[model samples]
Target: EESGSDSSQKQQSSQKSDSKGGSKGEGESENHEYISDAKKVMIEPIEAAQLDINHVVFLDPGKISITCPKDIGEHRSFIYDLETRQVVKLPDNTTVLKKLDNDDLFVMTKENTEYAILDGSSYTVKKAIMRPANVDNSLDISPDGKSIAYVTDEGLFVSDLDFQNPTRIVAAKREGKVFDMELPRFPKWFDANRIGYKVVGFKGVLYCGVVTRDGTVSKTYMEAQDATLYPLVNGDYLFRNDSGKGIGIIDANTGQKKFITESLLDKEGFAFDKNGKWVSYYMTNKEVTEENKWTGRFEVKGISSESKIMEFETEKPNAKPVENAVASPDGKFLLFTDMDMTGRRVLYKLEINAEQSQQSQKK
Candidate 1:
């Protein structure tokens, strides 16, 4: 483990440009035709009402769940189906926390501090499990819907769907130590038997690691001054490294790292397309921005080849920067929210005709 100051220095050094003095240019735009073929759809309008809609979670390509506040000061959850373009409100006052691979939903109602697993087909509570004491509100269900992992004041714990035979996978090692802290953030099931979590070290260095259900911690795969780990569909973990200077993917089994790109590493906006074959991130022209300072664009690239597939500029000058960009499950649509100058949050979807775009590139 490295000291907090040392880690901060290393992170800054990693972000500094190398001796060659790399050219500060937004490399040649690739697949320009792809951008022309894509279309933007307004899923939700910014001026619709006084409602604050957020927590958009895609259950699949066609279905999404979101949280909206009610007039009574309670939070209501609903699922929107793109196929029918209809939003169906959930029966309970709970908001969805996670949608399992089996389509089951893990939801929490803060009013009663209760957690339940809902059936995918019936939209009914399949089971109500025992709530952990001093819950950190970090919960994740396994893809197979058999196991659930969460965090508590004591430590990280995992149990079967029925909440039987619970096991404390990671002890609260920082408890009672100097600079003690609260529960970890985003304790998630990496696979059926393995989980990953973030914890604060002695010097406040945030460390992320994976552990087995039996309570064995794996070697720390990666660490940074600040990093949030998101498990990919293919079992790899994607995280911004070097204090948000770059994004990298780590092989869960081998601990090998492959950076997607070092350019625009300072931007905090990026997401993998639904199929995980493509990634879209926001970027600004280094040369142009050095002169103008208010210009930026979005870049889409192939994950394996690390090749740019398309690039497009936002609305410009008055363009609202995109935030929380996410791809639909099928990879055809990119969804994100942007707040206008008037402070209105608008949700937009970019539809990609990938097949047509590729054909155009070949021509």
Candidate 2:
């Protein structure tokens, strides 16, 4: 079982946890944008429960990573062991970023200026990196977790595992960015060779841009409206619109756009199952007529293949939307969340695969 840590303790600890049809090239494809609201298909989840945290990520089958809210008085992030029901606290004011292969996590300080690697096997700060002041709070680790990338006033920088031997491969002037507040969040590596970042058109519209490691930038395809970039596959990308928090995708080459869920009240309600079989996301049920009640449902679909849509219930009639959805490692289960009248986060479970759904139905 993994255990909690104090500011003084140092060691390792435990626990860790796209679709195709993008364009192929350099010429812009006439600003083709596809917007389709998620088709509503509400099904009762296999199980439902609630949690009291700001947000959470499923770490593995038996564990979860959770960040507590300031009002909750915990003011820290930790790993929650489900079967054992134990909690291991991480450093205060630190956000657990990505879980690394060596049982470590890439962490960003709450200040958003510093980054570090925390040992996963124990309670210890393995390394710390204070980035330049202009560095954006959002970052991404390479798929292998052996490298890190962040943006600063000087454009994009890449470094070994934890900010070691840094080099700026692409240089951007202030005028090229979407905002001057230095708050452009979450730069992603499409693969090892290419990196994707958010940019702005002359009209202040958002565009998801891609650049190769050799300093070659691609013709922008994500130029439809103002949307932030999320990775879907190698060339196609997922995007959350700048307004209304609608979820969509843009072609890495042609810039074509498609909406999965038109809008999500919460930022993290959308997630994918293990093995890339299905995507689960939350969206407001605008069709709901009741006032002062919860008005959202989750939708699921296959990425490379098609599957029956999966959804959760709005049984409680509370006002808050479902906040997040986390998939199990085996791709059989989806753990999702919402809120209660007291403002606590509620968790629910659904079986997506046929075998799991059958067993859950039997039980």
Candidate 3:
């Protein structure tokens, strides 16, 4: 009897072990099944939320970079970062695009004849190009950040960032025809490798083209019948006129086009939202005050028109003009240029709206 009882106990223990093993096997199988059956799609936001805007830093032609205090004075022409708090003093020259590559910067000398690359600590001479006696303009860096493109004497030229050897791309056609083009704006980057700029015709027609770092030219992106269009990055454009109405975009890959609304036409200016879904254009009406000062304010609109989503506004008729609007690559903050009473250009941060901007700010 004792032997039989012991044998029964052993058999019961073996059964319990098998049961637990079965459960373990089932749990493992269930985990695998859950992983395999699950599906996910990522959605990114477009228009962002508003935050307390402040000026972070300043860059100038003096080759000095300074962090700005909350109180700024008038007669200021510099640039800075909003988030990182980096500042660069532009040379007394035409040194735009304040912060150079996370730490350094570039400047055109006040004489507007020579250019330089500077860091906070020190700067190196980049190059000197022949300046025309009368034409006023600026310089631009290639999108890939490898070269510099600028116009001298109404002619266009490209050189490495280091300013080694210079090559002229555009030459004057006649006495009044600088490059024989009408729009007198500096070049802008399409990719790190190409630049888009306008060529003005004698007939007042604006012709836009893409030039490679190696100096190859593509056909005009768009031509206005009698108007001029400034190319914006990521397939959009700003139509500059007395009415300010001709903003549109053409896809770099597929050549698609879209135009802005008339409301956003006259005082409308655009900067890309942080997510790159929409470019925010501000619209304002002209007004005058009892103090005899010109007072004007504008509204902010994130355009996702291809997908039909518009969000946010400054909401007051007499707010302020939006200026120098730029976007962070991640599409989170639109760094805009604003002025205090002192007339200095300072950077302001506007957060992007996540849910709707991501959903609607589509191609």
Return model 1's CA RMSD, one decimal.
11.0
Model 3 lDDT, residue 7, Cα? 37
Q: Lowest summed lDDT over 10 consecutive residues: which window, candidate 3?
A: 38-47
Residue range 1-363, candidate 2, lDDT tens digits: 112421112121110001013332221111111111111111112111223555566666767776655543435677766556566777776667667656677777645667777777884788777765666766677755677788766677788755667777656655544544222234777777777776543455455567765555555553555666656544566666665456655666667776665655445456665355667655554553346323444456565443324433334443344455667766776665544334445444554663211010000
Report the lDDT of model 2 for residue 109: 68
Query: How high a TM-score does candidate 3 get?
Result: 0.55
lDDT order of candidates, best first?
1, 2, 3
Q: TM-scores of all models?
A: 0.70, 0.65, 0.55
Q: Which regions in candidate 3 have their CA more than 4 angstroms from the true location?
A: 1-103, 109-114, 120-136, 143-147, 152-155, 160-185, 202-205, 224-243, 253-256, 265-269, 284-319, 337-347, 357-363
Cα lDDT tens digits, model 3, 143-233, are 4345777765546677776444777665544565454545434566655666666665565545556666667655455533333445555
**TM-score of model 2 (CA atoms):** 0.65
Better of 1 and 2 by TM-score: 1
lDDT-best of 2 and 3? 2
- Write the residue-wise lDDT of candidate 1 on 1-363 in tens digits: 224543344333221223113332221111112133232233332134444565577888878776666657486677877666666668647778678877788787664357788888778889786665666656777777777777776677787765567788777765575666634556777667677788755555466777877786565664433565667788777766534345667776777777776555344347776345777776544453434543355666676656555555544455444665778877887766555334544445655544322211111
Each model's lDDT: 0.60, 0.54, 0.43
Candidate 1: clashing pairs of residues: none
How many collisions per candidate?
Answer: 0, 18, 37
Model 1 lDDT-worst window of ten: 25-34
